[model samples]
Target: MSQHHISEVPVEQREIGMLAKHREHIIDQIDELVKRTKYLELLNECQRHGLLSPGMCQNIKEYTPGRRNENEEDLLLERHRQLFKKLTQRGPRAYETIISVLESLDCKEAANVLLSVDSGSFVSLREANKSRRPGMTVVDEGVTTEGLVLSKVSKESKYQYLNPNEPLVPYTKPVQNSKRIVKKSDKCHEDAVTGTYPMCSQYNRGVLFMVNIIDFPNPGVIRNGAFKDGEELIHLFREIGFTIFPYINLNKEQYMRILKELTSSQYVENTECFVMVLMTHGNRVNQIDRAEFHDGSIAMVQTEIIAHFQASNCRKLANKPKILMFPFCRGPEPDKGVETDGRSAASPKPTAQPKRNIPTLSDSLVCYASTEGFETLRDPDTGSWYIQKFCDVMAEYAHNTSFEDILKKTQSLVQNMRTATGHLQTGNYKNIGFNKKLYFNPGFYK
Candidate 1:
C-alpha cells in the first residue's frame, strides 16, 4: 500500500502539489543539497532542460557586486541555495526538472531528499512528467528512454561561446568572376539521375575530411570534450558507407596541404562527394573566420578553405556536394531566443540555381553552428549542440531523406534547444551553386 501511494490531484498537478505541500521541508534541506551538489554539472543539466530562466544561470555563476571577495566554495554553496529557491518559485515543473537532473547525474541521495522532502511518500518525479509525453517512459525529469537511446544509442561537437560580428554568407547569385573557370556538371548527371549525390564505395576512403583541433596552443582555448564528437563522427559517417579521413591537431599550413593532397588525381577523379568538418574556436574580424591550430595557434581565413574547393582549384569536386560544417562561434551575440511551438517548416527553398556557365560555386552547402551574429552553446561534457544534432539527424534519416530536409531537421532540433539560462541557438546552411537532390544512400552501395 505504501509503495502504491497515490495522490488526489490530477497527474499534471501532483508534482506541484507535492512541492507546495513540502516547500519548507525542501527549503530546509537546501543546505544538505548544496553540500552534495555538483554545481556546474547541475547547471548544465538545468540548462539542457530549460529549467532556469534567461540569465539565471549566469547570475548563479558569478557573485553579486559586493560578494566577489568571498571564499569560492562558500560562494558556490550560497549560489546553490539561490538556485534551489528560484526553482521552487518556478513551481513543480522546475522541481521535476531539477530532480530529473539530479538522478541523471547519479546524485541519488540528493534526488531522494527532494523526492521525500516532507519525510512522507512523495510523487515520483518520473510519474509526474509522464502524462505529458505518452510514448515516453519518463526515466529522468525531461529525458526519456528514447532520448537516451537517440542521444547515446546513436553517439555524436566541442566549443566555447565566441560569437563574432559575422553574417551568414547567403549565396543568392553566382559570383561574377570573369576569371572563373567553367567546369561542366555534364559528368555528374548520371549520379543526379539516381537522385542522391553519387557516392561510390571505391571512393569511400576520401569521403570525409575531418579536421578536429583538440590541442590548442593556449590552455584556455583547448576544447575538452570535443574529441568525443570526432569519435562519433567517424563511427556514424563510416556506417553511412563513407570513408573517414580524420586529421588531428595540425599546423596552420598543414590544413591546406592535406586538402591539396586529397585533391590529388587519385582522389579527385573518383571522389563522389566532399565532406569537410572544421571543429575549432573561431574569431571573426569582418566576414573572415580565424580557425585555430596547434604550433602557433595559426589563424586561417574561412573563404580560402572554400576557395580551395572552387571549380578553379578542385576541378573534379566542383559539381559534387561540397559540405563544410563549422562547429565554432561565428559572432559575439548570444541568442536569447523567443518561445515558440514546434511546427513543420517546408524545407528552406534551395539557393537559386547558379547558371552553370562556368562551374560557379554550385553544390556547396556551408552549415554554421548558429545563425548570424549569435553565439552557439556547447556542453563541456557532450559536444556542440549543432554538430551533435546534425550527426544524430543524419544517422537516423540519411537513408531516404534529401540533403535539404536533413539540414532542416538538424536546424529545428538545434533551434528549439535553450541553454540553462535560456539562450537560444540556431544552425543554418547556405546552398552554393549546386542544386540537386542529394542523398547518401547508406548501405546501398555496400
Candidate 2:
C-alpha cells in the first residue's frame, strides 16, 4: 500500500474520465445520426406523395447512416423505412422537429462530428445539400413548416387577385395600313346602294401614271429651286413600267381635266392598280403651281383622287394595291432662328409632319420623300434624295423581296445615306393595307 498502490488509483480515475468523455461523444453522434435519418425518411415520404422535389431523395441518401457493409446498410434502410412510415401517419410535424434539432448545431460543426462515423453517407448528404440547397432560404428549400405554409399561402393569394374586367390599352393601332379616313367613309355609307366599276377589265393592263409639274411661275410656284430630280425620277419609274405622264407644262384647267379623265367612268373602269407619281413643290397641306391653287394638295394631285377611286363605280381597284411615290418638300417653314449666349441653341429640327397623304391600299404602298414636314433635298444633278433612293431600291429589290420588305429596306438605306452624306434627310411614310403581295417584277428580268 505504498507509492505503487497510490499511482494505480490515479490511473484508474483517469481512465474513468476518458471513458465518460468518449461516451458523451458517442451520445452526440447518435443524436445527430437519428435526426438525419428522420429527415431522410420524411423527405422520401414527401417524394412518394409528390410533395418533395427529386432533389430531396438524393440529399437524404447522402445523409443516411450507412457503410458499404451489408449489415450497416440494412440497419440504415430499416431506420429509413420506419421513419417514413411514421411520417406518413403523423405528417410533417415529425420532420419539422428533426430540422429544428439540426438548425441548433452550426452546419460545419455538425458535418465534422457526423463525417467520422460513416463518411460515405455524410459525404453524399453534404454533396446533395451543396447541389440542391446551396444558398436556398428555408422557404425556397421547403424544409420547415413555416416555409410550407408560406408557399401555399402565396399560391392561394395569387389566385384571389385574378381580374377579368381590366381595361385594355392597345400598344399599336389595328387600322395601321387602312386609312382611317377611308374606313370612316365606308362606315358612313354602309347601307348605301352603289354600282361597282371594273376599271382593269376596261383597260387591257394596269395603268401606271406619273404627274410632274416642275416649272410654275410666281406665288403659284410652291417649290423654289429648279426642277431638281422629278425628270430623273420619272425616267426611273418608266424603266420600272410606269406610263410617264408629264403634267409640267399643263395649265390649271388642263391638269384638272387630265385627273378627271383618269378618274372618269371609262379610264378607272378597267385599271387594275393605279400608281400616281407626283413631283412638285408642296407646303404642309397644299400643292402649288402657276396661276392655280389647290388645298390639301399632295404633290400636284388633289385629295379628291383617293375619294374618287373609292367611289363605288371604281370597284375594279377595290382592295387592289395603289402605290403612290411622292418626292416633295413638305411643312410650314424651315427651322431656322437666332441663337443665345453666343452658342447655337437650336436642336436638329423635325424633318416632316407625322401625317402623310398616303391612301390605304390593303393593296397599296405610299412612299413619301421626307418625314412629315421636313424639306426634301434635291441634287441639281441627281434630283430628290428620297426619289433617287426609292427608285434605286425598288428597281433592285422589287423582285427579290415582298413589298413590305422592300419598303423597310428602302427606308433604312435612304435614312443612312441622307444622314451620312447630306444635311437633308428622307423617309418613307408607309401605311400598308394589302390583301396580297404586289410583285413589281415586270422589268426586273428584262
Best lDDT among the predictions, by candidate number: 1
All models: lDDT? 0.57, 0.39
Highest-scoring model, TM-score: 1
What's the TM-score of each model vs. the native?
0.54, 0.41
**Candidate 1 local Cα displacement, residue 369, angstroms:** 0.8
Per-residue lDDT over 239-274 for candidate 1, one digit per residue giving the tens place of the 0 to 100 score: 665655676666667777777776655554676777
Model 1: CA > 4 A from native: 1-196, 200-206, 296-300, 339-356
Model 2 spans > 4 angstroms off: 1-205, 219-231, 265-270, 285-302, 332-362, 418-422, 443-446
lDDT of 2 by residue, 233-303 (tens): 44444444444444443444554556555645354455555676665544343232111222212223335
> Clash totals for all models, in order?
12, 23
What's the true lDDT of residue 232 in model 1? 66
